[model samples]
Target: MRHAETVTFGGSALNRAAELRGDKADVLALNENSRSIALWRGKPLICGTNLDQLALLPVSQDLFSEADEPPVPPIFLGQSEDGSALFAHDISAWEPAALDTAAMQQFVDPTQQHHPALPDDHRFVELRGVMAQLSARDAELAATARSIFGWHRSHRFCSNCGAESRMAMSGWQRNCPTCKTSHFPRTDPVVIMLITRGNKVLMGRSPGWPDGMYSLLAGFVEPGETLEAAVRREVYEEAGIRVGAVSYLSSQPWPFPSSLMFGCAGEALNEDITVDPHEIEDALWISREDMLTVFSGQHPTMKPSRKGAIAHFLLRNWLADRLD
Candidate 1:
C-alpha cells in the first residue's frame, strides 16, 4: 500500500542504536542521561526514574522474588534528542509485587498517595502524554523487549544439552554454561490481509474476540512458506476463499506475546465463503460504502478493528484511497 508506512506505529521513526548493545559502560552512561521515557507492562518496561529510583523500590527481587535474576547489563534502546542513551529495563527480574499494575498505577498517579501537587513539575506528568500516545518506535522497542525477555524466561535450559544458560550480549543472547550453545530471540511472522474482489472486503471473527468485533483474515506464516503463500493458505483454511495475486502492503510488530504482522491486499478468485467452524465463527463481505459506515461507527452489527493494530491501519488506508 502507498500509505503503508503512514500507519500509526509505522510512522514514528525512533532511532534504535543497535550497535551499542555490547558496550556495558557506554550503555549505562546513556541511561544515566536520558529524559523522555515510559514503561511497558510486560518486557521493555520504561523505567521513568534513574538508577537510584530502582534502588529505592521497597521490594527488590534479590530479597523477595524467586525468579532467576536478569544480568544487570543493560540493552541500548536508542537515544533521546539530546544524545542521552535510551535503555530498556527487564522488570521481569524484579519482584512481582513491585511491578504489579496496582503499584505502577500508583506511581503514575501520585495523587493516590495523597501527596500535594508540586506546580506540575512532576516527572510522571511530564512523560505521561508522550507515553500514552503510542509511537511506532516505542512499539518496535516494546516488541523487541518482550520477545527477548520472553526468550530468556522460556529458554533458561539449553535445548541441546539441558544445561542452564546465562544471559549474554546485554540480554540479546543466552549462552549455555556447560554446552557452549547460543540462543537468540525469535519473532513469528503472521499474515493479515484484506481480500477484495470489487467493492466488498472480507472479514472474519475468531472464537474469543469481543462480541460484534470482526477483522481482516489472518494467520501465521508456516515453516518454509512464502508470505504470499501463507496468505492464500490461511484465507482458504479459515473462510474457504480462493485468493490470487497477493501483494505486500505493510507490516506491524504486534507485541501481544510477540508477533510480526505482515499486512497485504489480495485478490479473491472465488466469491463464495464457506466458513470453517473450527477456525472462524462467522464470515462475510461488507461493501465499500458499508465499510465507510463501519469506520464512522454507524454499522448496526460490526465494530472496526482496534486502533493500535495493523488491521485498522490497513482498512483505514484502503478506505482513504491510499492503499491502491
Candidate 2:
C-alpha cells in the first residue's frame, strides 16, 4: 500500500483553498490572475498535439458568457503555481453542428468537441479516454470538475424540502432558501476486491459488457456497511464466493459518475464458482500466469481491463508483488 497514492488520479496534492470558499472578496481579488478550465458535457478541454495538456482559459474570456452554468459561478478548483487561482466552468450549452449523441453515450466515448471561439488545438476530450496520459494535477482538476458538475446537474432540487437550491460556497455546496438547508457533493463509496485463492484470481463480467471484458468484483457500500463487510457481501452476492481476511490495499477516485473506489485484497475461502445471473453474467478463476497473458494482450479469450482504472492498477501490482 506504500505506492497506493501513486495510482492514476491519486497523487495530486492540489491545494483546494477551502478557507477562501466563504471569503467573497478574497476570491474575487484572486481573479486578477485566475484562469479557468472548461468542461463540455463532462469532458475536459485538453490541448497539445498529444492531448496531454489541460487547457487553462483566461478568467475573463468571452466564452464564459456562453457557458450554461450562469447563476452558478465557476467552481474554484484550487490554488495554482504562484498566487493564481484555478477554476472550472461548464460550457455544455453550446451545441456542436454535428454532435454524435451515440458516441457520447458509449461506455467509453472517444468523441472530442472543439469550440469555434477557442484555438484549433484546444478540444474537449472525454476524461477517461485520456486520463492515463494526463499529469497528476491535470487529472485531479478534470475529475473534480466532472464529479461536482454532475452532482449539481442531478441534484438541483433540495432533498429536505423539494425546493430548488442555488449553488453556494463557490460550487462546493448548494443552499435551498425555502428550507434553509445546505447540501454538499456526494461521493458513493465502492469496494473493488482483488480476491485470490492460491495462484489464481477471481474475475467476472457483467451482462452487456463487451466480449472478453472481465474485471475484479466490485460493489457499492450500502448504508451502515463497513468496507470489509461490503467486500464480503458483494463477492458472495455476485459470484457466490466467500472472502476471508479482507485488508485495504489502495484507493482511487473514480469520477465516471462520482465514486471513490476502495481497493482491497481478500482471500477467497472457496474456489467453486456460482455466479448470480442478477449480479453478473459469468465468473471464473484465472491463474496468475494467465493474468499476465491478459495484461500483455496475448490472452486468447479475455481482454485487458482499462489501464487507468483501479482494477488494472491492483491487478498489475499484485502480479509484481507490490501491494505492500
Q: How do the residues 97-133 of candidate 1 rate in per-residue lDDT, one tens digit apiece? A: 2323554554233221111211112222212223234
lDDT of each: 0.65, 0.90
Candidate 2 segments whose C-alpha is farther than 4 A from its true place? 69-72
- lDDT for each residue of candidate 2 in 1-324, tens digit (9 for 90 to 100): 999998888899998988777566235535767888999888999999999999998878888876554524789888876858888888888788798889788878889898989889999999989999999999999999999999999999999999999988888999999989999999999999999999999999999888899999999999999999999999999998999999999999999899999999999999888989999999999999999999999999999999889999999999999999
Q: What TM-score would each prediction reach against the true structure?
A: 0.77, 0.97
Per-residue error for 217 in candidate 1, Å, reads 0.7
Flag clash pairs in model 2.
Answer: 1-324
What TM-score would you give candidate 2 relative to the actual structure? 0.97
Question: Could you tell me the TM-score of candidate 1?
Answer: 0.77
